[model samples]
Target: MPSTTPAPSDDQSPASRALADAVREIEHHVATAGWDAPVRVFALVRTQAALDAEPSLAAQLSPETLAAAQAQSWHLTSIEQEGLPQAPDLETLLAGLSWPATVDGVAVTAERVVLPPAAEAQMPSDPDEALPWLLAHPDRQDVRLAVGVLREGSTWCAVRTRANDSDDQVGQGPDVVPGLVSALRATLA
Candidate 1:
């Protein structure tokens, strides 16, 4: 007997809608990558104030959620905040983070990687010096940031996915190098 259970409607909730949409987009983008493991998408709220006042109706989140909240909204703010590490580098910056977390009773895991200080220092100062290497790395749906260290100091940048494979690239609209450069600049600042 074919029981006709209606599919879930899109009007679940504002936060759920956003979360579901984000998840779908992430899944679609991640599909081409050959990953047997499950990769969950989350939003990281940076400030304590943001964490406290998080939109209750926004969506389920994880420790990784802190980064998204930390991202600059506009192009100018993004560029102005160059050298400042964004959510993608949160895990890398903090080396001891575990896989799963409990947030408001919801459990989630963030698949992320961090570049060590030494590796960061080796990054090419000119985007051209480093862009090709950046393009050659893996295609991951998780946050990707460049962490660098100079003789005087260190820095970080968010590596966009598109610089390499045109088809599977993510976050290509804006110039990812600037934010990455900003993080590097700030680290050395």
Candidate 2:
């Protein structure tokens, strides 16, 4: 269930290269682990300049390619229905943050800031009140966002659940929880 954000090849233009590299990288990762299970991954690739010039393209497929190139470009979108979670859409209000840690066995970083169920569900009413405990971990990032560590039965799943929103924007909530957990095993490796 391992997935990737592939990168375009070097021989292509910087824009195309970025695209290919993202793809290749993801493909390589999945292949290395010999994953046959379905996995969801979202990747955005654009040259620094291209993104600077046309920011909307960040979530768009290139429009200039021939049929074959376009087909390759659409691979990610095509496979999106396979049920992998898409990364949260870019938000101008939230600064992207990456913090290293292992929740359960998967070692990865998350941007959503949250607290453990005890502190979040039982403790003080003030949001800032949880700061000391939430920020206590040296590995935790200092951001004005909620972080979460999902514990389903025995394993823990850490992620940044969206702020001010109960609806999960990424990953499976309950229906695909098992698959998501399986996918994490590969990510941890």
Q: Alpha-carbon error at 177 in model 1, in Å?
A: 36
Q: Residue-wise lDDT of candidate 1 within 1-189, one digit each (tens)?
A: 111222124554333332323333343445446334342323222233344565662355454544554452210001012232344443343332222222111111223333446665766789777766544545323343222212122211223332242323433211223544343233223
Task: Work out the TM-score per prediction.
Answer: 0.22, 0.24
Error of 2 at 144 (Å): 14
lDDT of each: 0.32, 0.31
TM-score (C-alpha, index-matched) for candidate 1: 0.22
Clashes per prediction?
20, 21
Question: How big is the RMSD of model 1?
Answer: 16.7
Q: Candidate 2's error at 41, in angstroms? A: 16
RMSD of each: 16.7, 17.1
Model 2 ranges off by over 4 Å: 1-110, 137-189
